[model samples]
Target chain A: MAHVGGPVRAWRDYTDGAPPPMLQAALDCFVEHGYHGTKIRTVAARVGLSVPGLYHHYPSKHALLVSIVQFAMRDLLDRCESALAEAGPAVEDRFRLLIECLVLFHAHRSDLAFIAASEIRSLEGEARSEHIAARDRQQRMVDEIIDAGVAVGAFGTEYPHEASLAIVTMCTGVAQWYRLDGALTPEELAVRYDTLARRALA
Target chain B: MAHVGGPVRAWRDYTDGAPPPMLQAALDCFVEHGYHGTKIRTVAARVGLSVPGLYHHYPSKHALLVSIVQFAMRDLLDRCESALAEAGPAVEDRFRLLIECLVLFHAHRSDLAFIAASEIRSLEGEARSEHIAARDRQQRMVDEIIDAGVAVGAFGTEYPHEASLAIVTMCTGVAQWYRLDGALTPEELAVRYDTLARRALA
Candidate 1:
């Protein structure tokens, strides 16, 4: 079940590419003002573009949100896959690697992580389902790895499904409270989370 | 460290009282439209009152948000105290009971929990600080329990602070994904989380 490479291959790598200025402006607006509170006009003004000019790129406010969320997810998935590739076939190693990747992603990209977690409600229809599916995929990955660990006695949790959910939830929560200026760097936080994740399954 | 009667005595008990209709209407609007997206007029319309009539009861949209968030936190804190009171003197028992209470609250009161978690950013000035202080109090309770457990050698986790956070994060996350119609009742979900919480500290 621990396939080396699959869906992660399909995601475009935006790891190094900063969001275009317009998208960043929209994201900042959405962050400061909830998605519903933010106006396309506000995004346009922030980006120093006309409404039409902003629309020329993003089409709509909803489109900008989708782009931002997707960008965050893709970069995360890309990092996850790369980490897993180097983790080899040991389930414990893969588990630790996955958690580290998640903690780092949530902490290092706290704003994007916060938006992705908070604004899922604002997404509608197919976009909502698509976003949920993508999120479920991430959860499923965690579940599978945990399940495999249990299968091989590499992990000891009886409730693999719940453990996976809890681990992912806590990791996602790093976005909620993690401050870049805080005592722990993202790497230190990742190490701390790695230990906690293991204890939850150990 | 586990002082029982201090803060709990000072907090008003709203555990059995549902929020008033106007506040409920405001909460519904805030939940549907992010705090930024909701209007006082909309909440007024939902409750069949004129704008000034609504303002007479609740001064502004911000006031509504603050009231709703405070309601959620007070109820949670009240319940946490009651649970802790009955949990006896053992650190592990208190730990289990606290997690159970959190899991149950987030699952049963998913809407309030969701708003409390998601809309904290929408709060401003003193309201934001007050809300956060209340929240940190809850975390500190967990931290104190974990630290006590660590001191007694009942909990093996070296990273007590991180473990406390991870446990609370996972419990709060129940609000995001829990559905009443889902397979698990709140009690059942609470048991699952209780096990995971112990595993994290074991």
Candidate 2:
């Protein structure tokens, strides 16, 4: 299922840019205690700031969450677009690259991705809608690839939309269980996932 | 991919046993505000009890969460075992039934499943180990089936463990997105997933 002709980029090389100091602290606290369990004070304390000082930057706990979510989504989408551009025109190749991108991001950025997945409920109003829209955009990338693959007989799955969703969900879920100390590297896991995904489509 | 010899059970018919009043209220609060955000007093208030009164049945907020998680895991494992037993001896049949059972459990008991998946971090001590063990038991069910299928040449995937994890992850993820009011019913989604899973194995 891997692209045979070209050099596959190292999965570790693609990353959701490192979060700033405050957001990194917030991510740590949120991952440890969850969104609701985390306190603005704790986040402030982590960064050696008073509550009022932290407020000068993020304004609210929700704002901190919004900033983190936006960063995660933008970084993921940017990587997906770049992977596609680098993957050339074959739909199958594009599909493999997208899967690798998703699996690697979820595995490498597990904490940030975990907060994004588990804390969607904490986001409200405009943040919630924008987050959902960003998620939908990610879904659409895989959807279009599968649709194109099927159109050209490169993939044979009858339910392209649901197949795309299943593929994305499985990939996104790498955040929930993947461990850096575990048996597989992000690169190996990405290969395993891409192979399984391509076989499913076949 | 669906079984053809006998009447396939309705996805709606298999259900997690409902929680009584207090646990249900706790589940609601946890789902809405999260485990950390929900107060013991608020759960007591929802059930018309004082803090001590609610504590009579469950000692702490963590206890309530453990109860819910235990219930969710027990119910899911029981359903999966039953689905496999009813599926007879065919590896393909067992695989399809297991996928349906997982999809149905996640879609029908989404709140309970969501809490179980998201709040594993909140579980402490023995409860955490027990929850992990039960989850491994669920994973093992799929793992063994895929292993058997691969051993018998009924499924062609080279990576059985990885494939099973991908299948289970995608199916379990239904809890995050499936809705009662959505375009597809649980049964329809189950069939679609079964088709996708089977094709992936093929």
Number of the predicted model whose TM-score against the real structure is largest: 2
- Per-residue lDDT of A1-202 in model 2, one digit per residue for the tens? 3533323443336433589999999999998898889989999999999999999999999999999999999878887887888889998789888998999899889888888888999999999999999999999999999999999999988888778889999999898778889999888999999988987787
- Cα lDDT tens digits, model 1, B86-173, are 7889987898888978987887777888788888878999999999999999999899999999899998887788788888999999
In order, the B-chain TM-scores come to 0.90, 0.92
Q: How many clashes does the backbone of model 1 have?
A: 0
Q: Which candidate achieves the best lDDT against the true structure?
A: 2
User: What's the number of clashes in each of the models?
Assistant: 0, 1
Worst 10 residues of 2 chain B by lDDT: B3-12
lDDT by residue (A12-118, candidate 1, tens digit) is 22344566788789888988998998999999999999999989998989999999988878778877887788678998888887888898788777788878888
Question: RMSD of each candidate?
Answer: 4.9, 3.5
Once superposed on the true structure, which residue ranges of model 2 sit more than 4 Å away at CA? A1-16, B1-16
Summing lDDT over every window of 10 consecutive residues in candidate 1 chain A, give the lowest-scoring window. Answer: A1-10
Global Cα lDDT for candidate 1: 0.83
